[model samples]
Target: MAITQIYLNLPVSDLEVSKKVYTAMGGTINPDFTGDTSAQVVFADAIVVQLMTRETFATFTKRSTSDGPIEVISALAAGSREEVDRLADAALAAGGTEPREAQDIGWLYNRAVDDPDGHSWELLAYHPAGGQG
Candidate 1:
């Protein structure tokens, strides 16, 4: 199946601060979808993340927010290992937390970072050099 677009909604305590963190990590804010309670953060052409305030998000679901445990780890493919490191570093410098160092396993490299709101994001790159496919 070919998907046109994907939007991941996240509940944040501070909308503007979340937008800033995402933008610092190379994501773009879509002013058309941004408002006082929510902001659309676009990472790629088809990937858009909606950052909504806790109060605003509650309108969509009845479940309480899960900001403590590891709810999810959103991973995106990078152009190269350098790009992975760069984006991860940017997130860390902009108030995001790096849970661990970059992992390189011959054909794949990955790094994880948690945004200020405790949203985990893993940046990864695949190198086909030592692969047996």
Candidate 2:
């Protein structure tokens, strides 16, 4: 079966802080699927991020959550290099941390940011034609 949508589930330390970071990254909270211990943030119509308290996240599996290590790095595509910078800047302003310097290679530009809970996100703009402009 073809997958129509993607839901990324992450364990967060602070629910409110996670919400603010996602909002700054251009996501909208889907209240219909949100509750006290969990929240659903929609980035695009087909992309949804489920943020849960570490306690609540344990209900889904026996795997342990670690605050020290990054298990995944989620990347999002932007329409332009400026858009990538905009989102990254917004995320940093909303309590996220920049993990590294921005990367630009003529055809692609990207910046990485980590949320308050330490979830990593990469904002990128790719132009297959070799140059952004």
Candidate 1 regions with alpha-carbon error over 4 angstroms: 66-68, 128-133
lDDT tens per residue, model 1, 27-64: 99999999999999999999999999999999999998
TM-score of every candidate: 0.89, 0.95
Give the TM-score (vs. native) of candidate 1: 0.89
Q: Give each model's whole-structure lDDT.
A: 0.85, 0.91
Q: Compute the lDDT for candidate 1.
A: 0.85
RMSD of 2: 1.2
Report residue 60 deviation for candidate 1 (angstroms). 0.6
Residue clash pairs of candidate 2: none
